[model samples]
Structures are given as C-alpha cells and as structure tokens.
Target: MSKVLSKEFLQRWAPLIVLFSLCIIVSIINPNFLSVRNFARLATSSAAPLMLAIGVTFIIIMGSIDLSMEGVMAFCGASLAVVMLQFNSFVEWGFLAIPVAIVFGVAIGFVNGLIHVKLKIPSFLVSLGIGFSCIGLTMVMTGGVRVSASDKAFRLLLTERFFGFPLMVYVAFAALLLAYFIQKKTALGRNLYAIGGGEELAHASGVKVERVRIIAFALAGAFYALGAMFAVAQIGSVASNLGTGFMFVSITSVVVGGTALMGGIGGVWQTLVGVLIVAVISNGMVLVGLPTYIQEGVLGVLVILAVALATNRKAIQLVK
Candidate 1:
C-alpha cells in the first residue's frame, strides 16, 4: 500500500517537478531566461496557446480529441478582424464582435458533436473533417487575403500591461479559472471523468454520456474562440493560417502536462503547467541558441515519453 501511494504521488507531481527542473536548468544555462522581462514575454507568448490547450483539455478528458482548433481559431480570428474593420475599430460596437465570434464557434462545435454522436463517427475524424471545412470556408470568406485587426483598443490586450504582464495574460488566467471551476465544481465535469474512465459504465450509471460529451465540446469551442481573439490581439493580424501551429502546441502541452491520451486523467491545472513547460523549453532553446527544428524534435520526444508514463500498460493488451 505504501508503494502504491508513493507511485500515485509521483505520478501526480511529476509534471510540476519537471517544470521546476526545466526552469532551473534553463536559468542556469542562460541566466537571462529567469529575468522578469523574459518571464513576461513567456507569459505573453503563452497566452493564446494556453487558451487553445484549455479548450482541448475538456475533450481529451472525455476520452475524445478535437483537431478542429486550428480551423475554428482561423475562422473566428478572421471573423473578428473583419468585424473590427467593418466597425472601423473595436472602440465602436466592434467589441460585440468578440462574443459573436465565440457564438459562431459554439455553433460549429455543437455541430461537430452532433455528427460525432448521432452519426456514429469517431471524434478525431469528425473534428478533422469539420476543421478542414472551416478552413476552406475561412479562405472563401476572406478571399485568401490576410485580415488585420489593428485597432488600438483591441491591441491593448498585448500593449497594455498590468503588474508587469500584458492584459492578455490576465484574460487567459480568467479563462483558466473558469475552466477549473467547470472541471472541479460542476456536474458536467464529473460526468466527463465518468465517460472518459469508461463510457459504457458512465451510461449505465445514468450520466447522459452523449449530452455531457456534446456540452464538453461546446465548452471547448468557446475557449477556442477566446484563443482566436487572443491570437489576433497578439499579432494584430488574422489569416487562414492563423491557427497553423496551434494543434501541435495545444495537444502537446496537454499530454506533456500529464494528461493521459487514453483519457480519464488530468485537468486544467496540469494543462497550465504543460503550457508553461513548453513555453519554457521554447524560450530556453532560443536563449541557448538551439535551432527551431531541435526544439520541435525535443517536444515530440517529450510527448512520447509523457504518453508512456501516463498509460497503464499492464491493463492494455492492444495498441489502439
């Protein structure tokens, strides 16, 4: 029993320990990596990707996947830029465009869930198809042109600083808080764990598995919309490829933060740690003059290791 408890403790705390270790190692290699200014930069750079990771956390926790983030983010980001342009600036009613974009995301997510459950399609394939469709639609909407949301008010998310961190960081924190609440304090959160642990068992226990799954996906979409807005705020530009690199970052952060790919484990806090870990690694590599390709390769290896650590291999006989 003591051995079991020790194993559990280590599994629960390993991600955090790794995170601290990475910080120390990087700070040692390049002391400037520990500076307040660099920390602020890390937080700023992580804000949008953190939102994306938070969104996918729900889906992954429910034993499902969401590859649609890139497409959803691309669509929403482009839409936000167009709305801001139409209103001349976010200082006008363009601010309303934020919620509107999120609503669009919610609708798309709802449909993605509907198709996944009602049509008996696997979530990954369903989400991937929807994402492709969204990307195509986004290209058509913008006529393959890059849209800019250079409004001073909107860009303030990046430009305005409070307590040495940009406002976007705070916004991402708020979103994180909201996700934590949902995961820990709500019936939906409970149901998500139930389904991920064992869908048939959850359904047997009268958990309304399908409904919970759909709700989880919709919730994820809302966060994706926020990610889209944040991305535009960070760069002041939105193109069809705005979400190009997010899929890898968000998924990788989730898994590396200690979330199991087979689901039924991990939460938003782990995701936050995971995002910070990735951010630290990326920043540290740059500070240490490591190539981008090396950074990507390192992240890939980390993902594989994380998956192996998080999986219960003894109970699994199949590799699917």
Candidate 2:
C-alpha cells in the first residue's frame, strides 16, 4: 500500500518537482538568477504568456485549439495602440480604453466561434483563416508601420509596481483567479470538461455544448486581447509583428503545465506553473549565456518530453 501511494504521488507531482529542481539548478549556476530584481522581472515578463496560456487552457479543455491567439493579440495591440496614439493624441481616458479593447477582443472571438459553429469547420482551419484575416486587417489599418506608445496612464499601468511587483503581475493574478473560478465554480466549466471528454455525449447530457464552446472561444479571445495590451504596455509600442510565434509558445506552456493535449483534463493552476517553468527556462538560458537561436530548439525538445510524460496513452487509442 505504501509503495502504491508513493507511485501515485510521484505521478501527480512529478512536473512540479521537476520545475522546482530546475529553478534551483539554474539559480545555483548563476546567483543573479535568484536576485529579487530578476524575480520581479521574471514575473513581469511572464505575465502576458501566462494570460495567453490560461486562455488556451479553456479551448484545450474542450478538445479544441485556437490558433488565432497571435492574430487576436496583434489586432488588440494594434487597435489599442491606434486608439491611444493616432486617435486620442496620448490623452488619459481613465481606464476606458482597457474595456474597449476587451470588447473588441470578445467581438473577434464571437466571429471566430460563429465561423466554427455555423460552417461546421474544424477549429484548426477556422482559426488559421481568421488569424490570417486579422493580420491583413492590422496591416491595412497600420500600413505596416509601428505605433508608438502615447498614453501616459496606459504606460504607467505597465511600468508601475506596487509592493515590489509590477502592476501587470497583479492583473495576471486577477485573470488567473478568474479562470480558476470559471473552471471550478461555474456550470459552464463542468460542461467544458464533459465536451472535452466526449462532445456527443456532452450534448446528449444537456450540456449546451455549442454555446459553451462559443463562450470558451470568446473568453479566450478576450484573454488574448488583454495579453496583447500588456505586451504593448511592456514594450511601449505596437507592431504588426508583435504577436508572432505566440501560438506555439502559449500552447507549449499549457502542455508543460501537465494539461493533456487529448483534452478533458488539467486546469488554470497547472497552466500557471507551466508558464513559470517556460519563463524560467527562457530567462535562465539568457542568464547562462546560451545562444538566442538555440533556445527554440531546446524548447521544442522539452515540449515533446513533457507531453510524453503527462499524457495518459492507455486511456487514448490512435488508429496509426
């Protein structure tokens, strides 16, 4: 009985153990990696990706993927930048811009959901097409140019720190908490799990599968928009290419957090830990003087390994 219990414990907690060990190893290699300033910087730098990962976690929970993340983020950033720069002339609007950006995000997500549900198309293709369309739209709006950060208040929201933590970190924590609530306390959350487990079964069980999926996609879009806003705030500018490569990075974080790719499992808290692991590896690589170009390759390998360890292959069967 003790041996059986030990095995279960290791299976459940192995990822966290590995992540903590890596942190310790990296810090030992470079003491600066453990400094307070670096810890703060890491939290700030990871905020956007963490938001993105949490958003994607919902979509994955429904056995679907949202590749429109990069496009959604780019659109949000571009729109926000244009509003605060070209339209408002850097005037402070007292947080009104944030809600407006969030609304735009939901609208984009709704459209994406409509396309998927109405056309009966696979999410992958629908999201890819929508993402491309958003990119084209952004290009047309910005004329392929960068938008400078002009809003003092918006900039402060990104740069300011409270109690030694960046404002963005607080925002991220709030978002994470909201996600946790939705996944745990809401009926919609339970429906998501059911759909992920078996869509037809969920529909037969009166889960309102379509509505839940649409809402999930919409919520993900909102999160992506928030992430984009944070990105622009952090960098003080917006470019057409601002969200490039985010799709894979966000998905990687989710998978690393022990969320099953086959779906019907995992939660936002797992995503939080996964985001930290990815952030630590990336930050540590830089601190250890690894070449920037090699980072992607390293991440790719780690992603495969993590998936292999976390996935329950016996529960899932494949034709191939």
In model 2, residue pairs whose N, Cα or C atoms come closer than 3 Å (at least 3 residues apart or on different chains), thus clashing, are none
Q: Which residue pairs show collisions in model 1?
A: none
Model 2 residue runs over 4 Å out of place are 1-8, 86-91
Model 1 TM-score on a 0 to 1 scale: 0.97
**Candidate 1 on 1-320: residue-level lDDT in tens?**
78756977988999999999999999999999888899999999999999999999999999899999999999999888887788866877889889888998898899999899999899999999999999998999899998878889999999999989999999899999999999999999999999999999999999998888888888888999999999999888989999998888999999999888888999999999999999999998899898866766788898898888888899899876
- Where does candidate 1 stray beyond 4 Å? 1-5
- TM-scores of all predicted structures: 0.97, 0.94
Q: Give residue 146's lDDT in candidate 2 (0 to 100).
A: 92
Task: Report the lDDT of model 1 for residue 279.
Answer: 95
lDDT of 2: 0.85
